[model samples]
Target: MPPSTVNRQWLLERRPVGAVAAEDFRFNEADIPVPTDGEVLVRSLYFGYDASQRIWLTDDGGYMEPIRIGEPMRTMGIGQVVASRDPGYQVGDLVEGFLSWQDYVLARGDGPMPLRVLPPADHPLSWHLGVFGVGGLTAYFGITDGLQVKPGDTVVVSAATGATGSLAVQIAKALGAKRVIGTAGGEEKCRWVVEKTGCDVAIDYKTDNLDARLRELCPDGVDAYFDNVGGDMLDTMLLHMNPLGRVLICGAMSSGYCDVKMQGPSNYMRICTYQLTVRGILLFFYRDRLAEGAAQLGEWVREGRLHVEEHVVEGFEHAPALLPTMFTGKQPGKLILKVADPD
Candidate 1:
């Protein structure tokens, strides 16, 4: 006989202060859910930690409502349906949504996290959590729709070795940027971004002087800045930007730091003087049109034009601790927590 399975989850115990800790979340097990009418029970496979999810943990949640005490931590993940009460979905269907930090999710077909079926398991489910999901699409649109990069343009992507940053570096090249520079916090990551992601120059911010390096790397001035690490990096890049430069605001690594220590950017004047265009992008805005980019990125990955990486961890127990690494820049790539495999 098969062993009994239970749904294990982490509930928010309290809001995080500096770095997220195990004390902030309480883990417990519950009976695997039975789907009601129009609901499907999806057994989660791989869940990923996004930098934005940290914003939801704070009392002042920026975009969406904050996760309250005693609520399941909101995360994006992929799962295979084990049982179903909805005609639109059936058993064995892999789905994607705001699957929480848990083993299973009972989702309605039309809920806020509407039950959308995923592509067949051609690649690892983690890829769905990457290029096929938010990371690749964010780069696709952030470049095509936001920056509109051109040949001979210099595009510098901060957090270059990250899931999104890695893709952005490659996509910038494919989109005709003659020079693509990436920034990471360490030498190992810096080397990976250049060697693996094909970035023309990789700056290790932890060791090198970023301002001095940027001045040296882009003597013509930065034509486009794809900012993922926003703090002093953003300010320094701002000072080096050429006229008509565009700054794409994908993530704010700085805003969160300031939230802890109370600080803001000192580079507004540079933006004004350079006549730069600054627009903050939200993937939610591209919801309906997401497949266009996802398909393109999927083709690129399959064609070996771009590569995607995952910083995968096994089991749900380590999730709380694993999430803090993104903030600290210790994670290697798109951080995926593998929970289970498809039946």
Candidate 2:
């Protein structure tokens, strides 16, 4: 980082009442600060845009404390160290962590460096922020550990066209599911899931009869349900669950956005009737096993068994506009904002 360089940041302006507004996030430009002692200054390369980012804006907050008003929005980013004062990270070491929506950041210590120097080479650099990143790891662990997909089990994934669900559906196939089913919105997403993503069937939950379609797709019963979109879709999936079924509660995008009472599942009692095992995943809980998850996903990517789709957005100027794309179904796959090219 040079003293003359200017850093642009997307700061949280105000918490939103419902859907994120352009005014909720405001942009600012500042001089790039130099790395202090025991710190590394990195140039931001990419940003990971997850649905959970919306929840992070709420007053009550989700998982972690909400991003403070008028501060740089907290996000996962891939970056390359431009200057180093830390022993752990060298100049040009590719790392991923709590990099904000800014052009440059000061990584102070190991606390900020979770996964170090491990960007994808076989695939594009964006994969490190998408498929081989947190979203991909969520699908891998949520399936392999949370759901534990078996050779002949019937597995279903909600929001199957989204980042985590899409990967989860394919991982189940790679793990040898007898039948892999997905629930996506609209014809294009449904067709893409079944035809391109290798799911046995795709239920267009927006227009189709979910109950009828699930029954047709999983004749025996749904052995595992990898849920991303919660609310009514979850309730329907629950009704068709097999005995001793596994439900990986990867995310509740709907319940997080809407009033929980209005959108909450009514068929939760099915969990008791079916003797289903339900596990919620937060990704951070499996921090110790991230390497194992990444290695396997990377291998699957190399073998062409796993395919990753990244909806890459360029420029720091577009950061505020891109944040709203996730909630509106405008983004095609995993959303990543590319800020700077690696030198």
Candidate 3:
């Protein structure tokens, strides 16, 4: 437990108009909250950053409640149970779930994503917020179930350097994809994607002519496209997909996630003309199967088939500053902020 009695929090000061900035949050200290019946008091250890957090700031909150002003910033965090009023959780137990940008947070087991009791593992606890967390799990299901990528298929993943995209590339290969292609912004990132994630070819979206490259590299047309970027990239990929090809809409990083509104693919007509199967992935839908996904991911990791990457920033003060980097350029892999250590 933290020695300080006051809770350190970063509250949403105002709704962001465009890109989120650190000024949007105000730092304040308040008395540590106590858990009531059916509630668990968690001391946050690490906070995982996701693009969806920006959507949560919107009025609609996407699929969950909006982060109102004066409330602690919401995040998917790993924490230790310092106190519990719920029968399922006990003090000293470690958990992962929806927490907030504070030293202590009150959590309940009945939220859309319940508090998960983390079992002992040989991996680092932070791995639970990364490879075993949302990004890795999303990548697992998105490739295996959403796109149904199979052997001898040509698979392509955009934002190849991102947390989910990085893993999606490898998972597709593990599924026996004949050709695994990835898209990154530059030559360095493109090279890194191919080297680190086992991508057969990496397209430098910034320098290379994407359509031509896809035509030249994937002469048979892309069989499966794991789209992390929407907008123009989605439109381009739509035109290159083989008949009966599959597409998984995982994210729209192109929009910057500033507002809820996003541009739809202009070449969506190809979905009909080519008889393509397009699907969207929201981890909430596969909440029950998360363990199954994680288990497979673990096996692949142990077998040296999957690579895990993380960009960890220390100190809670850096939380607000790190969020905007998701839209801007950031290093490859999962982005995490270390707040405190568990007792």
Which one wins on TM-score? Answer: 3
Candidate 1: list runs displaced more than 4 Å.
1-5, 109-113, 255-263
lDDT of 2: 0.82
* Superior candidate under TM-score, 1 versus 3: 3
Every model's TM-score: 0.93, 0.94, 0.98
Residue lDDT tens for model 1, 117-206:
887758877888887777888888898888888888899998888788889899999888999999887878888888888999899988
| Alpha-carbon lDDT of model 3 | 0.92
Instruction: Summing lDDT over every window of 10 consecutive residues in candidate 2, give the lowest-scoring window.
Output: 255-264
Writing each residue's lDDT as its tens digit, candidate 3 over 1-343 gives: 4547989999999999889999999999999888999999999999999999999999888878899999999999999999999999999999998999999999999867898999898888999988899999999999999999899999999999999999999999999999999999987898899899999999998889899999999988999999999988999999899999999999999888877888798898999999999999999898899889889999998998988999999998998999999988999999999988888
Cα RMSD of all models vs. native, in order, equals 2.3, 2.2, 1.0
Candidate 2 residue-wise lDDT, 168-199, digit = tens:
99999999999998888899888889876799
Backbone steric clashes in candidate 1, count = 0
Runs in model 2 lying further than 4 Å from the true structure? 1-4, 108-115, 256-263
lDDT-based ranking = 3, 2, 1
lDDT of 2 at 98: 75
Query: 323, model 3: CA deviation in Å?
Result: 0.5
- lDDT of all the models against the reference? 0.82, 0.82, 0.92
Clashing pairs in 3: none
Could you tell me how far off, in angstroms, the CA of residue 196 lies in candidate 2 after the best superposition? 1.9
